[model samples]
Target: MNDGLAAVLAALVGLVGAVGGAAIGGMAATRGARVGAETAARATARQVQDQAAVDHMHWLRGQRLQAYQDLLAAYDAYSDAVKAVEQWASREAGDAGRRPGEYVQRVEAFLRAHMVIRLVGPVEARTMSAVLWEALQTHAFKLQDWALLVERRSGDETIAGAREELAPARAAMVDAHDVFLSEATRVVGTPMGN
Candidate 1:
């Protein structure tokens, strides 16, 4: 071959090698950028999911707190209603009208609150709530029966016997209330911590 022809062929070979190297580098850069983009996208999605889970936990904690507060408040109302009924029963028959409706309303409120506790519970709290609710109901019914006997102008001995029967029920209710409170406190962690 001529020396000039040999030089031309070598130049062509070198140019082809340079073009191929450029193409390979360009493809590698594009692949790296795509992988980087995919990685960033996955990280962002994971962060969003973690944030959502935290938000849900906060919301659930708030709900449980609210339910506990409501149930406690309802108990207060029911107790007040019972007191009112007892007061009416102790007075002269005509001094104050019967408060059966008020007592029933308070009991209904308590029941509704209890239902919320059952719904938002962590099992342990729910069990305690059930015990407390049963005690409350038993005491309320006994008190109602005694009040009715008083309204009927029952003998002193009969009324005293009925009143005496309330002691055990009242004690049970008090004990149940304490247990329920402790369980509720345990289950309902601090707002910031939960």
Candidate 2:
């Protein structure tokens, strides 16, 4: 071949190689940048999700604490109620007989004590649920029926009636507490479940 034509063909081949190399490099860079961007976005999304979960848990804990404080106030009010009932019974029912008005006071005291003491078990159950709420849903409801038992033991057959009584207040409190915890637990553990 003539030198001129050979030189022209060599130049054309070099130019084509340069263009192909640049295109390959550009494609690689695009692919790498896309992967890096996706990775960063995933990390950011996960961080945000984790932070939101923490904030929600803090709010729920505050709610649980408020419930507990209300329960404590209820207990204090019920204590006052017991004292008032006793005094009233003694004054209103006192009489000399096989069972004087004092007997009514005794009965009232027994009922009050019964109601107050039953609170102990429900409080314990509620506390347990709160402590474990972030972990498991099933555990939070393991004692679902226990709330009814607590009411029955306090002498209320109907659920609403139990709420009217003091012991049933604690039982209902525990039930509410458990419900909140169970919801949280279900949300938290769902990913872990499957």
Candidate 3:
């Protein structure tokens, strides 16, 4: 009976050892799986963030392109209007009535185009764009004043004075356009029209 009791005690010890080993191994596996899952979650989150940044940059590029296009269009329209008004002033007094509203429409178109610049232009480009707009506005005002004087059949000296007033504004507009183009190229590659 003592030998039987010893044998049973030995078997019981073996069973306890096996159970403890299995519990420890299972805990180790569970901990490893938890760490692996956490790693995967972090990787997935980083990928998603990277993708969002790429998408945002693409959208911003498109906006910049459109804004640049609009600004160029505005500049062209304004420039043509100024030329037209100058031509009208040079024309015979009777021919001046043919397109009295054309210059005004062009100025309005230019003002409308500025809205796009405000919406999508980056800070550097925006500053240049503002300078361009102010110069164009000054040119437009001087052109309008000159047109009025022309309609009144004012002397050549008065008309020449108005024309002279436009020179500085034109120079400023050209300088601003050049700066804006340079900044835009830095930001979005060469401009479409160029």
Candidate 4:
């Protein structure tokens, strides 16, 4: 009777030990899996955030490029209008009439473009654009005044003298245009936040 009782007791102890070991092993595996899943989730979130930042930077670069192209085109149109007006001024009585409205429209287009640059800029380019616009406006006004004087025969300054007087303003506008191009190009070429 004592031997049978001892065998039964030993069997019960072995069963409990096996069950306890399995439970501990299962708990450890669950904890390890949870930790791994959390790490993966964090890594995925970080990757998404980094990708969004890159996309935003690319979009901003494109916007700036478009703004610059528009501004340059508008400026060219304004310059052409100024030339047209000057040519009209030079012609004698029997020719086509002047289109002052066209000049005003071109100026408005250029100003709109300049305003866009002011909205999206690297400050230096914006400042140069402003200086360029001011110089151009001054030159255009001087040309208009000269044309008026010529039409009315009120001023003694000849066309040659008018050209000489405009030379400095033209030079300043050219310089400003060059500097704006340089600064804008540098800004576009550099990486974000640099």
Per-model tally of clashing residue pairs: 0, 1, 0, 0
Report the number of the highest-lDDT candidate: 1
* Residue-level lDDT tens digits of model 3 in 150-172: 88978889878877887887788
Query: What would the TM-scores of all predictions be?
Result: 0.88, 0.49, 0.85, 0.81
Q: Give the CA lDDT, 0 to 100, for residue 157 in model 3.
A: 93
Across 1-194, the per-residue lDDT of candidate 1 in tens digits comes to 99999999999999999999999999999999999999999999999999999998877778788888988998888888888877787787667575465877887888999998788777887899899999999998898888878888788889889999889998998899899898788777655423
Give the Cα-based TM-score of candidate 2 against the true structure. Answer: 0.49
Index of the highest-TM-score prediction: 1
lDDT tens readout by residue for model 2, 32-135:
99999999999999999999988876665555444444434443444454444334423422231122123233333433433432343235434444432222
- Please report how far candidate 4 places residue 18 from its true position, in Å: 3.1
Q: Which portions of model 3 show Cα errors greater than 4 Å?
A: 1-3, 190-194
What candidate 2 gets wrong by more than 4 Å, as runs, is 92-124, 127-194
Q: Is 2 or 4 the stronger prediction by TM-score?
A: 4
The regions of model 1 sitting more than 4 angstroms off are 94-96, 190-194
Q: Per-residue lDDT for 1-194 in model 4, tens only?
A: 69999899899998899999999999999999999999999999999999999998888778788888887888789778877877776676346364354767887787888888888776777887898788777877776666666566554556557767777877887787788778778888788722
Ranking by lDDT: 1, 3, 4, 2
Best of the two (1, 2) by lDDT:
1
Better candidate number, 1 or 4, judged by lDDT: 1
